[model samples]
Target: MSLLSVLRAELAFGMTPLLDMASISVLEGERIGFIGRNGSGKSSLLAAMAGRLALDGGEVRRRDGLRVVLVEQEPALPLAASLRASLAARGGLRAADLEGDDWRSTARLQEFLQRFDLDGAIDPQQCSGGERKRAALALAFASQADILLLDEPTNHLDLDGIETLENLLIDEQRGQRAAIIITHDRRFLDRVATRIIELDRGALQSYPGNFAAYESRKALAMQSEALERRRFDRFWTQEEAWIRKGVEARRTRNEGRVRRLERLRAQREQRRERLGSVSMGVAPGERSGRMVAELEGVSKSFGVRAIVRDLSLRLMRGDRLALIGPNGAGKSTLLKLILGQIAPDAGTVRGGTRREIAFFDQQREALDPDKTLIETISPGSDWIEIGSSRKHVIAYLGEFLFPPRRTEAPVRTLSGGERNRLLLARLFARPANLLVLDEPTNDLDMETLELLEATLADYEGTLLLVSHDRRFLDNLATQCLVAEGNGLWKEYVGGYSDWLRQRAPPPRAEPTAAAEQDGEDGAGRQARPLAQRAAKLGFNERRELESLPGLIASLEQELAAMQERMARADYHRQGPEQIRSDRARSQQIEVLLEEKLRRWVELDARRPA
Candidate 1:
């Protein structure tokens, strides 16, 4: 039942080994989730399996007549072709060629197009990032291949799109097809993967279940290792004591014991080397005032597409905030606005006098492809000065899994995940009061993402994060900011899922009075839903809508002024009583503002067609 088998694979980037002595087999009906830290050769192995990349060592054996297709992050399509035409081209089934053969081909093409919300008439070139990703997925799902290899399939998918894709790729009736996916979406992996293949340190380990099961098994293995280590140490201690007893006048008869002692010492060192831990904890820098940053009446537009408008917000000490939106929805623009990198069309942005900000730009624009990894951190030096401590460049790079021997290699040769790790190392090395991260989770593996969450949790500085990783947000963010790109921003208290529930479309607005009278009895119509009762504001909704802009502006000004006052050195030194009172007042204003904003979105959704 085996579909493919990778036997004793060995791969290295230059002299830096990637996959070493790794072997894995792909069996029939297996949905394998390929996972590991960044730059662990997951992509390389996938390419090797598809015969796209030549393997440096080890042969890949496939079942005869196996049809394997690898779908990458970007859809490789004819730019000028219409969406429908592209699908036809990928499926190899022309409209005319499909005469009466299989109508299911046309039916499936239409279903996938609709699921992705793609307009068939539009050129693929004109689609947005998410749209292109969806189109690629739709094509992959429509292919005739028996084995599908997907890379970061959820990169640009929205929540609904993700679920729809989950249904398609991880169905209960998987038929004869099998798949392998590379993704950081924990939920997606758990829902789709029948097995987990982890590639790390040039080694491969296969777990027979999903991510959760893998964690459980790994924990148990660690527990067993701990016990074994203790036993080995105890036994080695006795042998060491005997060996240290001078070996009976250095006699040749003691050579066997001496060799046994050396072997035990080597074994201990090997274990320690395999279990080494890396610390990414931040160094305490200059503490900022209570108020970090504030924006008032902020608006930005690109060629009449209003990305943000009339937005106001305050950032206080220790604020871990996340910005959520679809691709191209101005999340990055908002980050720039906070940092004052670009002037908003109209707004006032204030940054604290002591604010020291560190930005992790998702675009990876800071990296120079021509520069070596070591040179990126220190121009010509072998160490970096972080606050009062000097960290060695080699050691620092090691923390991010960059081998010192590869220090001379250019940055362009690194994988997507490795680039992200390099960025993190460079950014976190500088002590800062605020950290602004844009899509930091894009190419990271689940392990790296969890480590990032841990680092952020331990960080004392304020955080502004823009990401689509739901797990990361729920763990690290204290508040959520939803940006809808049409000049709309909403703040929710909990994580992404909480925000989803808070915004779940209210049940179909009660039918019109005429429909209620004609379709139901008077008594049934009278028993209206409580949730609907508040939304049935004949003119109040409109009036509230009219006054919201001004009211929100007023509330923002009041809160910003108060927070700025409280940020003063003397004001913060005035003890906790005054601080509590000001926070209470600000919280009240925030609640009132959120309620009004929720009403605004509801009224907008209820607007007449």
Candidate 2:
């Protein structure tokens, strides 16, 4: 039997049709991803399936004795209840009801909490945003529902938390349990989705395979449609010319036919025009100086506790920096200091003169929840009235995957991912020479995230980003700044993977005379001053470390040579075996070049003044 099925479902919110004759069947162990633009009825359809929103027509069916659970974008856990109490209230295994009288339920809850890196559950009332979401997810997992519905499950989850959720879903899939996940996270969809179902115009359409397949299909469909339109246009032009050139009697006889043809052409044109493009425009700005921001001896302290200390760094133009560390490790504090939002206890913080800056904070608190989407997009406009600007609003929201009808909806009514997309839509609508983004990808869908990444990759500004999304950082960041223990900050000159390699504790150092002389044979070796080693290294070692420029130039030469060889191999009419060998050789060269590039990064990191 099917785990769940919706047949000819029809639902509406007041005058708006939320779902119109939408039919879908989900079987046991099937993992489906529900995708659509903001306000595209994804949530409404989920609600209808869960029996929270009554269907106007048709019916929903489920297997006998099957339990269903729905998790919303903004998880609704009772804030006043303790974590343990909340879990117990959710009808899960209780501590007192567990066999062996071992507090197994409590232990399980603790295990999940620790797995998500959440701290002690003192007064769940005061839990952080991320913590609350984690707690809610834990309750859902503990409930052991047969059919699980997750809406934007990755919202507010860090990279580690997202990975944990992915692993949980994979485990469930392996166990033959079914799930329907509504998310904009492309990476998550790529990892977990077995199939994708898009909710468009209150109708459901299933795409076989994963999110990537859906995208490829959509692109191909659009291209085919474009080709068909061009063909129709050519035919229509010829027909119109023939009609205009015809004798008077012939024209009179064919007037009705021409009118009918005109109507058909108009209908086709309308259909073609309905597939709107994602348009985005950034205002022109003056180029920033080589150094966008600089910090020297910077320290921030709250009362007696230090958050950041003695941090010194320089942000150059075109530098894309990712700030990473554990929660509450002062990543945000460091950003605030850079933005001058808070004064440092001691140090010099400088930014390039005349540099224009834009920031997208973690919470996106800059957006007013009470405001309508149209109002948010064009605030205090005299010429473009709220209702009159529907076309403009639709055009603008299209870029962020929001529909025209959602422009008048209150921001408060939008989902987490919707709000995040709106904030980004607004951010990109403007232009700046420097951008400071904190967790920009938190609530965005995979498609939107890819668009944002593409936009940023082409952005000609300095970027200081704080994100837990490894893929986002790997794709966009050219440098990394880690907020480490004891208010310390370390900067690496490469991307996330490069930073990880550098951070891997340097291979155990061999015992030396200095180690024995300083009585630092074992534990004391770690205590040895790094300054002493720097002092001991000779000028040649320093020069070797500083040879990054030369190495980079040499790598560039090798890369160019490899490209030339690949081009020759492609153009030459060699046998299939020789062609295959050439391709393999080219790939080997590319791999070597990548390794050398990483080595250049390491050398750059060790450069002396």
Candidate 3:
């Protein structure tokens, strides 16, 4: 059953078309992942669907009295109200009303707040970005709306928060509720989406499945579309050649052929071409010393709170490292210490020789809102040097999807994603042997994210990245430095998923003598001896546990071999079926490895102390 439908939507900004005859429907029990390039009006489409934005032409039809909620990318709350009061207002209830007879409503609201780990009495204005996002989500979920329009809900969320949201959204699949989400988190989409809707060149295209399935299907579609386009162009070219023949031939040309040629010209004129991808490159400066940066027993703190306690690590040349932690985990402080911008409180930090550094700030503080794009890229001259070649500033901005008209516009006019792209444009314009990026993937579109990932993968410089994007970290990081609570940080080999596999669970507390004698713990569960726990497993389970290590090793070898094959340039150019098959197999291996690792952990927990 359809909850809402958009009919031939047409919208435009000035001379640019934002939604050109675009249409879509929201059906019950469907979670749609809305995607597109940056500045392609994805947010606007959400607004229109939520009845917050009026279309210039066409209409939106909603089921009678259907409740729809729109969660903005950067949600704004009433400054003077408490978080609980804000939710009350959003749900069309007064705070006083909630305090009275509506026990169910109040309980529901509190439940969501608790689930999101938010304080209900806190002022909305005092909340952090992640907290604010959680507040908005809590409001959305508590509203019990028929359809939810969520824009970048994962923007400021940490890995744990993202996982929580993924589970909640997946649970929504069992109900009649529906959602249309606009996000750049690929893993989130793969986990939560029942279908994918793409907004490309002012048109909406739907793909039936999750992100991985969308990738495979879109690849094949693009290939077929390319072939069809070539055939059309070939015929158009022959018609053009015939029409341009001598005047005598034109006078004698068949009337029917002339009409067909005119129709062809019209058809060609009305066609919209696909937007080009971003062309990005880095200029790696002169090689630095083999040791990039090293910290000896580094410890940092503010007053009584320890940020990084006795953390020691060495960064070598060509090392691609990632910092994973919750917000306010002192990632910025760690970066500053490594860069020698700030001294550690109790340890020695050393920087390598001849190291030129470039940084991408997550807050985009380095960008001046008043400056034009051209001025930002090339300050004093019309041309700038990129590695040995000098290129016009306007041309360089164009490569980043900034039109010539927009080059002279101030940075404040650009959207969030556009601002990030501009920052990337500025960052890569310079040469550096060390790159430190903090949350660089926050507002980037998927295409730009993939391009940046590829560019960084090919970079010769040592990289230090702090991002919450799981897929991005998996693709690029060679090592992960994870924050284990209470200022302790640990380093693991490989990326985000690697850290998950290698990390051990917190040790269980030993039972007291009294509890041992009683054969029960304080929680009233059985407190078995180590031998008894080991013997509890069935024969099949024991066999599986013993075989897990071998299975894990075999899968890792296969995954590594597949990765090596994919590293070759020719692997990507293979047929769509082969490419899709390889991608599916790779994902399967990763999933299997993670499952086995989890089982191994479970089984290993029962071993003798």
Which candidate wins on TM-score?
3
Task: Using lDDT as the measure, name the better of candidate 1 and candidate 3.
Answer: 3
lDDT of 1 by residue, 185-213 (tens): 87677667889888766888888877666
The Cα error of candidate 2 at residue 110, in Å, is 3.9
Could you tell me how far off, in angstroms, the CA of residue 62 lies in candidate 1 after the best superposition? 4.5
- Write down the TM-score of every candidate: 0.72, 0.70, 0.89
* Stretches of model 3 off by over 4 angstroms after superposition: 246-253, 506-558, 568-609
Give the better candidate number (1 or 2) by lDDT: 1
lDDT tens per residue, model 2, 381-436:
52222222333655767666677778888899887777887777777656588888
Residue lDDT tens for model 3, 420-529:
99999999999999999999998899889988987998899999999988988998899999999788999999999889868996676676677666654453245654
How far is 10's C-alpha from truth in model 3 (Å)?
Answer: 1.2
Off by over 4 Å in 2: 14-16, 79-81, 92-107, 119-121, 224-275, 303-306, 369-418, 429-431, 497-502, 505-609
lDDT, residue 254, model 3: 74
| Per-prediction tally of clashes | 1, 3, 0
Model 3's alpha-carbon lDDT is: 0.87
Where model 1 places Cα greater than 4 Å from the true spot, the runs are 1-29, 53-65, 73-75, 78-80, 83-107, 120-131, 158-160, 201-203, 226-277, 346-348, 380-382, 506-609
TM-score of the candidate numbered 3?
0.89
